[model samples]
Target: MAFLELHDIHKSYFLGKEEFPVLNGIDLDFELGEFVSILGESGGGKSTLMNIIGGLDRNFDGEVDVNGQPLDHKKEKQLDDYRRGTIGYIYQSYNLITHLNIVDNVLVSLNMTDLSKSARKQRAIELLQKVGLGDQLKKHPNQLSGGQKQRVAIARALASDPEIVIADEPTGALDSKNTAEVLELLEGIAADGKLVITVTHSQNVANHGTRIVQLTDGKIGEDTRLKEAYPTNDHQPEFKPKILSAGASYRNAFQHLSYNFWRNSLIMLGTAIGLFAVLLFSGVGNGVNAFIQDQINSMINPNSITVLKNPTGKNLSTTELQQSLSQYSSNPSKLLLSDHQINTLKKVKNVDKVEAGYQFSAFTVSYNGKNNSGQSLQTWTKAYASDTIKTGHAPKNNEIVIDKSQAIALSSQKKYKSLLGKTVKLSFAWVDKNNNPVQVTGNLKIVGFANGGQAGAITATNYSTMRNLLNNANGATQANFASVNVKNADKVKSVSKDIRNTKENNKYVFGAITVGDILDTVNQYVSIASIVLASIAGISLIVSALMIIVSMYMSVSERTKEIGILRALGERKKDIRRLFTAESILIGLFSAVLALVLAYAGSLALNHVLYGIVKFNMVQITWGNVVFTFVMAIVISFLAALLPARRASRLNPIDALSAD
Candidate 1:
């Protein structure tokens, strides 16, 4: 029985409704250990017949039987397996992948084998050595002479140990010496118990084969056997589906990208700029929030909630109430918190203590006839005990801690530091029981200089002290607000909410505020600002994605024949897609890493310059930001590569192989 058989093969090319028959009914038989040449003139259907035999042009009508099994041309996977396991092709153009070295080009075919990586490498090197290009294994195809490149192609063809070796004009580009060398190698391959077939228009090339078949007008006009077929060993390697490892794919991608390093670097820089802006802004937002919290923490107790009287009923809008609160003519009765309201605040959950305080919208301080008038004042409570004292001590009975600036103004020597232990007189207007305003006065000893006191004078005395002076002067002593201290700082927010939610007569009675609440509002604004800025910066990333798509499509166009070579080596379409996708991912990863470095550097520089003024790091890059940046880069790159990769994978091998 014949080792290979082609029965009644018919092929035609269609131009619209017209049919141009390329191959008529042609029957052929072949055995192992035979060097057969199909010789014909140009346009004699020689290459078309070779394409059919190589399983690349599967649209032909034929029965191709190999070792007693009929080839199913319609099944793409079957055709792929047939080409990968049963035949090896050597093109006249050498068709070597430009980015791969000589040995790597050969290994491309061996990679489809189930052999281990080391074994595949060894086999590829052995094949290259057999072709007499062993020392040039690391050289790229462009570095080689035409003969050397054809030698590499030949080595690649034999790397997988295919049952049939098909050479299409193997010596068409070589000189006489190189032609003889390649012909001798083909004869040697046939002697090793494999069928070697060559298609060529040169009669001298056909004469070197053991048998010659003449093709004329798509038909076999003559068949001649020059020598008897040698005995066949009939041993073939076990067939395995092609599996391109991710590592191999990435290595290929890296090599290809490295060929155009400067171009790819520019793309990475464009992408990195966008990523840097986003990461930097995000870090700045984080730092600003932290700084705000730190300042709030130092200024006020986080566990304390300031409860203000609801100046207007629920019928009033928030804006109207704020306007009324700011006005001095608004009724003081509405702003004053009664003892009953204070008691109700003490009932709030997590409330450890409630302290009543009084606020004077306007006041006057007199010391040695130096008067500072129209100053705001607040009576001290336990919550204000934590205030830092720059001089003297906390206020005692009939004593006040004045602002340093006010102390300086009232000092005869024009030095506030010298007035710490001095005495000052305070006077303010308050409402009496008859709802009429009256003046009140008190002589207070200067104790300490602290914040959160009178706006201009820094005067703060105990609530009892202020209340006593008002009561004696026939003035109302109602508290303006109350401070409710929670058991823990973390419970301040919940406790404050509960107080604000407290209702009486179907109306919210008290408004509650805490340092945490103010900080949260500030942080929310900062976050919104950061997102808007980052989104504007992200426009560059979209532009970068479009750049990637353009770059990848160019790559597909430039490496069209490379794609054809890989497909002929038995690579699946998905593998081709992954190869291009891998290149894009590498570009993204490079950009992301570069962006992170730039962002951190910028943050360090900004922080270093601002450290003296702000006394804190103003940019903080978190691990979350780094991770999110990387993920965004990869996802965007993958999406950008999709169309290009699909186009590359779907390219017709025959047409791609024909590309320049």
Candidate 2:
């Protein structure tokens, strides 16, 4: 039985409903150790017959049998296996992958074998040596002469040890000397107990082979034998072929990326810039929120809930009541908390201590002929964070603690600290028992200064001082607002809920505002602002993804021949898709690393400049942000590569190989 057989082969090309016959009922038999050359003219069925036997052009009328097993052209996987395990092809153009070195080009075929990695490398080097191009292992196809490239192609064809070596015009592009050398190499391959088939139109090339089959029109016109076939050898290397693994695909993708490193770097840089903007903005947002929280938390007591008399007695939220605090300036008597309300608050659950305090709308402080007017003038309570008092102590009886801004205006900025123990004239209005407004004036010592940051400007005196002055002026002594401190930090919200739910004559009696409520409001606004800015920066990310998509498509166009070569080496379509997809993922991962570096640099530089003014680093990139940036980058690139990869995988190997 023939080692490889073709029975009644027929093939045709279709041009819109019209058929052009290429192969007509051609029967052929090939044995091991035979150097058979298919001699034919241009437009003969020689190449088409080779394609059928090689399992590339499967849409043909033929039965190809290799080693008593029929090749199933209808099953894609089985045909791929046949091409992978049974046949090797060498083309006239050399068809070497430009991105790969000579040895790497050969390894592309060896990668499908079940050999150790080091063994494969050793075999590839040995094969290169066998082709007399050992020194050219590091050289690419473009760097080599036509003969040298054909030698490398020969080494690649034999790398997998396929029983049938098909060379289609192996020396068509070479000179006479190179042609003789190539023919000698083919004869040597036939002597190794394998069938070496060369397709050529040159009669001299056919004479170099042991047998010749002439193809005229679409039929075989002559089959002649010049010499007997070389005897088959029992000692042959065992080969177990496997589908291309994921690691090999990724390795090839990386090599391809590195070969065009400079071009790919531009793509990586574009993607990195977009990621940098998003990551930096996200960092800035994180920093700004942190700064706001620090400033607010340092000024006010976080556990204290400010409770006010609900004059309207309606179901109002904490925000509405807080907003209306200044609106009560015209009718301060309406906001005055009564003894009954204070007692009711003290009895509430989780109420650690309820201190009845006065929060007047406005006050004026005069010292050394300079007067500073401010709002939210309240008597001293635990509501103010004591550690924030930069000078002197909290206000005692007959003493006042004013905002640093107000102190600077009352005295010079240089003398504001010195004015801590100095006397200041304070004046404010309170409603009398009959709800008539009464203005009271007094001399109070400045005991302390409060740095309320850019947001808070306040003035305060002792509750006793304000009450006594109001009493002497026949003013209402009832407290307007009280500070409700909770026992545990966790229960602040629940306790605030209870205070708001407190009833008096079927009406809500008090409005409670926790520090969380204030900070939450600030947090909500800051978060929205940050996300909006980050999202704006994300527009560049979208553009970057589109850029990657374009790059991948261009890569498919550029590497069309490489795709064809890989297909001929028995790579499945899925492997082709993974090649592009894996390369894009590498691009994204590298871009993300670059973006992280850029973001760190941006945050550090920005923080350095801003810290000089605000005394705080306002651009903090968290670990979570770093993780999210990488994930976003990879997802973007992966999604962008999908369609391009599918397009590349769907390309026809025959058409792709012919692409210029």
Candidate 3:
């Protein structure tokens, strides 16, 4: 029985519904270890018959039988398996992938087999060595001569150890000497128990085969056999099916990318710039939030809530409400908290204690012949007591905690530190019940100095001292603000909220301010600014994605033949897609890594410069941002490669092999 058979094959091409027959009623049978040449003129269907026999052309009415089993050409997967496991093809043009070296080109075919990677590589090297190009295994196709490239093609074809070898005009581009060398190689393959079939127009090429079949106008005109077939080799190597692994695919992608390192690096730089901006802005936002919290916690007691008059039901607009609150705090007026209100605040939940405080916008402090006018004075309270003191201690009953600047103004020789133990005169004016101007004066010892007093001297006196002074001048002694303290810092927010929501006289009671609330508001604004900045940075990412899409499409166009070579090697369409997609992912991964490194370095430099002005790290990168940036890079790259990958996977293997 014949090892292979072609029965009643018919093929045609259609040009606008007009059919041009290429093959008609072709019947052929072949056994192992035979060299057969299909000889014909141009357009006489020699190449078309080779295409059918190689399983590249399936649009024909024919039954191709291997060992009595007919092939279903309509099933693409079956055709793929048949080509992969049964036949090896050698094209006249070589069809070598430009990016792969000689050994790698041969390895491409062996990769479809289940051999270990080391074993596959060993086989590829052996095949290259057998072709007499062992020393040129690392050379690219463009670096080789015509004969050397043809030898590499031969090595690649036989690397898979297929049962049949089909050569289409194998020596069409070679000289007479190189042609004889390739023909002798084909005869040697036939001697090794593999069927060698060559299609050509040359009578000399046909003479090297054991049998010759002549085709005229898509029909066989002659069938002749010169000798009996050789016996099949009993020790042919067997190959199990294997699919390409992701790691191998990525390795190939890295090699291809490295081949054009400068170009790919430029693309990576463009993408990294976008990712760097996003990560930097996110880090800056984090730093700003941390800095604000640190400042607030340092200046105020975290367990204390400041209570002010709730000016809500005053029929004021938003701007008017702000003005009213400012005016009420700055001037001594009806906004002052009465004793009833103070006791009510002290009764609220989580309120450990309530400290009533009075504030005067303008006052005078004098010592000897020196005087500091237009100073602000506040009655000492527990919340304000948390501030750091430069000397002495917090104010006692008849003592004052004056600002460092005020002490300097009242000092004899402008020695502020030395004036801490000196006595100072405090004076202010107020309106009596009859609206009469009354003056009050007193002498208090300066006990301590406070920081941040450039605008005016912020002097703190005991609450009783300020109350007594107001009483002497017939002025109101009501406290304008109250500080409600909670036992635990964690309960400050809840306690503050409850105080602000409390009601009295059918109106909302007091407006509450907690350090946590202020920090939250400031942080919220910082985050919004960061998001806006990052979004602006994201425009560059979109542009980068478009650039990658164009780059991948160009790659598809340039590697069209490589795609064909892989398909002919038994790669599925999904494999082709994965190949292109993997390349894109590698590009993205490289860009992301570059961006992260740049951002971190930039942050370090910025923080170094900023720390001199403000003792804080100005940029803080978190693990979340790092993970998010990498995920963004991968997802965007995958999405960008979709169209190009699909186009590569859907390419016609035959047409692709024929592309320039």
Best of the candidates, lDDT: 2
Q: Rank the candidates by lDDT, best first.
A: 2, 1, 3
Model 1 C-alpha lDDT per residue in residues 1-660, reported as the tens digit of each score = 888899999999999999999999999999999999999998999989988888888798979999889988888888788878778889999999998899889888887788888888988898888899989978999999999999999999888788889999999999999999999999999988899999999999999888999999999999999897766775756446466777778888998999889999999999999999999999999999988887666546777878887755553333344565777354676578888998998877789999998878788889777898746587776555365456777777888877766766677435777777677788988888777878899888888886533122456788888888999899877888898889998888788778877888888777777776677778989999999999999999999999999999999999999999888877778889999999999999999999999999999999999887878999999999999999999999999999999999999888889899
For TM-score, candidate 2 versus 3, the one ahead is 2
TM-score of each: 0.89, 0.94, 0.86
- Model 1 misplacement above 4 A: 234-241, 311-332, 359-393, 402-416, 424-446, 450-461, 466-476
Give the alpha-carbon lDDT of every model.
0.85, 0.89, 0.85
Q: What is the full ranking by TM-score, best candidate first?
A: 2, 1, 3
Off by over 4 Å in 2: 234-239, 309-334, 432-436, 501-507
lDDT of 1 at 370: 83
Clashing pairs in 3: none
lDDT of 1 at 73: 85
Predicted candidate 3 versus true structure: per-residue lDDT over 1-660, tens digit per residue: 888999999999999999999899999999998999999999999988887888878799988998789988899898888888888989899888888899988888888888888999999999999999989978999999999999999998998898899999999999999999999999999989899999999999999989999999999899899887778858657676567777767877888998878888988899999999999999999999988877666556788887877666433322344466876543446466789989998888878999998766678998888889854677777665366465678888888888777776676435778887888899987655554567878898888887643123457898898888888778777787888889888888788777866787677767777777677767889999999999999999999999899989998999998888888877778889988899999999999999999999999999999998888998999999999999999998999999999999999888888888
Model 2 Cα displacement at 437 (Å)? 3.4
* Residue 76, candidate 1: C-alpha displacement in angstroms: 2.8
- Model 2 lDDT tens row, 367-469: 9899888877888887777687887788889998888999899778787788878899988877898889899888998888888876678688888998888
* Residue-pair clash count for candidate 3: 0
Best by TM-score: 2
Cα RMSD of all models vs. native, in order, equals 3.6, 2.4, 4.1
Supply the global lDDT for candidate 3. 0.85
Worst 10 residues of 3 by lDDT: 313-322
Per-residue lDDT for 572 in model 1?
A: 71
